[model samples]
Target: MTEQQYNECVNLYSDNVYRFIVKNLRHQEDARDIVQSAFEKMWRHRESVEFDKSKSYLFTVAYNQMIDHLRKVKRINLQEDFTETTKGVQHQQTPQVKKALMEALNRLNETQRSLVMLKDYEGYNYEEIGRITGLNESQVKVYLHRARIALRNYLVSPENVI
Candidate 1:
């Protein structure tokens, strides 16, 4: 990719990559670092990166870095719901409902939640999501199906309703 292509790549995909990372991590600073690192890696390899696949490349790099970051942090806390959005800001939707769905989403394992975000939230196709998450397309489909089931079960459970 030329310098112009690289700049265009950054402009086009930076927010998307950043949002993906931030939603998974739920930590703005760490997400920012990981996103920047992904971009830097892409920058370093721009010569070999196809301009058309830059979106995939950026997302793949960002996803891997996020998994690495999670492993490194060894965070054990999962009790907190996914209540916050960008930069520690809480969602101001229907007060009771806001927490319920997020709670269900947070109940998912890391891989499952990320898959849900990539497919349902980020609008990635199975093949694209598989590339980004290092899973096969079939695996992506299965995991995503299971994740949605889990979300549905959680949301419909009487104890979880707002």
Candidate 2:
């Protein structure tokens, strides 16, 4: 990744990376910091990064950073707490919906969450996700299927959605 490549990567994937981080971390400010730090790390490692591999590298760095943050924070940091931390928090009667969704997502293991996010949220193809996560295409597909089923079951539970 030359300086030019780094710029292009930022222009192309910054928002996607930011969204992924924010969704996982549930904190925009922390997400922002993580993104900036990821980009900075990428910039430093530019010489080793190939353009075609940049997106995977960016996501890997951001994902690792999020994991480290979660480990270091050492707190549950529930959805209500995250909403309160928002700068322009809105009072919504749908807290139950958000809570249910969060619970469903949390029920997934970290790899499942990442695979689901990459496939469903980010719209990455299974091959792409395989390359990013170091899983084979079949493994990616199988895990994604299982994750989706689990999420559907959790979300459609009577106590959750109702």
Candidate 3:
């Protein structure tokens, strides 16, 4: 990609990329850093990256970076500590249902959570989500189906809503 094409890619995809990272990480600073790193990676490989594939390339990079960061910080273990986190959130003034929803989201493993976020929040189709996540389309469909069922079960549980 030429410099102008790279610039256009950045302008066109930055917000979507950032939002995807932010939804996964929930830390604005860390999300910003990950997004910046993805763009940098794209820039470094600009000569080989085609303009048509720039958006997917950016997302795939950002997703990988976010996974690496989560692994580095051991945030994946947070799923095991969900009860403690939810206890604290319960004491906050946020609405009960929203808090429960967030707690439910936190309970998901990183891959499942990413699948839901990319599909539901970001409107990525199965093929696109698979491309970003390195899953096959069929695998993406199965995992996403399971994640939604998990979310629905969490939301509908009497203990969660109250």
Q: Which candidate ranks first by TM-score, i.e. highest?
A: 1
- After superposition, the stretches of candidate 1 with alpha carbons farther than 4 Å from their true spots are 76-84, 87-93
- TM-scores vs. true structure, each candidate: 0.89, 0.75, 0.83
Q: Name the top lDDT candidate.
A: 1
Writing each residue's lDDT as its tens digit, candidate 2 over 1-162 gives 678878999999998898787766767788899999999999988999899999989988888888788789864453534444443535464777767766788788777887888888788899888877778999999998999899999988777766
By the TM-score metric, which is better: model 1 or model 3? Answer: 1
Candidate rank order under lDDT: 1, 3, 2
Q: What's the lDDT of the predicted structure labeled candidate 2? A: 0.81
- Candidate 2 regions off by >4 Å? 76-103, 134-139
Worst 10 residues of 3 by lDDT: 79-88
User: Alpha carbon lDDT of residue 130, candidate 3?
Assistant: 93
Superposed by TM-score, candidate 2 places the C-alpha of residue 24 at a distance from the truth, in angstroms, of 1.1
- Compared with the true structure, model 3 gives a TM-score of 0.83
Q: Report lDDT (Cα) of residue 103, candidate 2.
A: 79
lDDT of 1 by residue, 57-147 (tens): 9999999989988899887343323455454444567867776877777789999999998998789999999999999999999999999
Pull out the clashing pairs in model 2. none
